[model samples]
Target: MKKVLMGMAIASSLATMMFVPNQAQAAVEANIGATSNYLWRGVSQSADSASVSGGIDYSDDSGFYAGTWVGSLGDGNGAETDFYLGFGGESGDFGYDVGYILYHYADLDDGDFGEVYFNGSYADFSFGVAYTVNSQVDDGSLFDTGDIYYSVGYGFEVAKEYSVGLTYGYYDFDAGSDSDYGHLQVDISKGDFTFSVSRADEDSGDDDTKFVVSWGTTF
Candidate 1:
């Protein structure tokens, strides 16, 4: 997906990205991006700082796709790499996607995880959910099967080439209800550049409202 459009919606939670391959033919694509701050599921992955990222994706007309993305973790020289595969298609204005993803953090202990996601969309509105299915944490019980996230989003063009998007997301953890959190995001974009602002609920451990400028392109 294009970064600007992807940012305007909630598709999945994997290094700030989710993919649904719906191309009509087999294709290979590459993309690169830079963000003032890398936020994943409403949490700053770049410590409220800047980060650079890039990825390559492959898709087939049959709705099968796979991709890998990597980016600076904003924690010193640490980095995060992600791999995902999924199937997606549309009938008229409605579409659906199902996928699995894995996240790996280099030089970060206990930071690896795996999730499965489902998404459905109609027109400009979208809904999605992801469940944690694997973890590298030592306390696996607390980080286990009960972790899940839900999200909703809507996007529309405000002008010929300018657009606005609104998104809301919630997280639930098995550890405790107190650990749950939610966030809202707004995005405005034209072409390959985007401006965005988001805020996480106080329960998310970080209540700060974040603003970000980002540019991305694919070929």
Candidate 2:
């Protein structure tokens, strides 16, 4: 499952750090959160239900970071677990990150997959892309790999401890899957709470506009 992989990834990150003693800054953190609706690329993963999640992350002064997250899906597939590791750093006003992430569904058949991603930001604008690579499913309809996701975002602080963010994303599915779609999301956050609204360009199939309320904290 994804949770299992995340645990493995965390352990691997720690092991790798052991060999680079001078570069290891050693910082571990944890996070917890709840969301009114769990949405992924404009689709509801929780069937429009609320879900809770928790995760731990390890980061060094250098740019290496690894983390895991597990959240209830509320659908028949049960919980979705994820693991990711990447390097990120800032240069003046620009920042960049490159990483690999794995998503696992413990109870769903052929639902485990992984992707390599790259993201960059300059000031308040950001762009990113992710490509699917390894997939556990072997069926003809693999439903994985060859899919790419592209996103552009802008964020700005409206006031102290308050911010607004807008993102537009497009998913390029593998050939023969006409399910490709694009979505735009707006989020307003203050402290630990956030309000988000999103709509997909496609009007057909579960593309209904969604409004979600969420809260999260890190320590």
Best by lDDT: 1
lDDT of 1: 0.72
Model 2 misplaced stretches (Cα beyond 4 Å): 1-24, 138-143, 202-204
- What local lDDT does model 2 show for residue 168? 81
- Give one digit per residue, the lDDT tens place, for model 2 in 143-210: 46787878888889999999888878887767445667788788888887888887776534557788
Candidate 2: pairs in clash? none
Predicted candidate 1 versus true structure: per-residue lDDT over 1-219, tens digit per residue: 011001111111232233557466799999888888887767777667788888899999899889988877554747778888988888899988899988777676666778898888889988888898988765633345658889888889999999888888887877678767888888888998888888878453457998888888889
Cα lDDT computed for each candidate against the true fold: 0.72, 0.69
TM-score against truth, every candidate: 0.89, 0.85
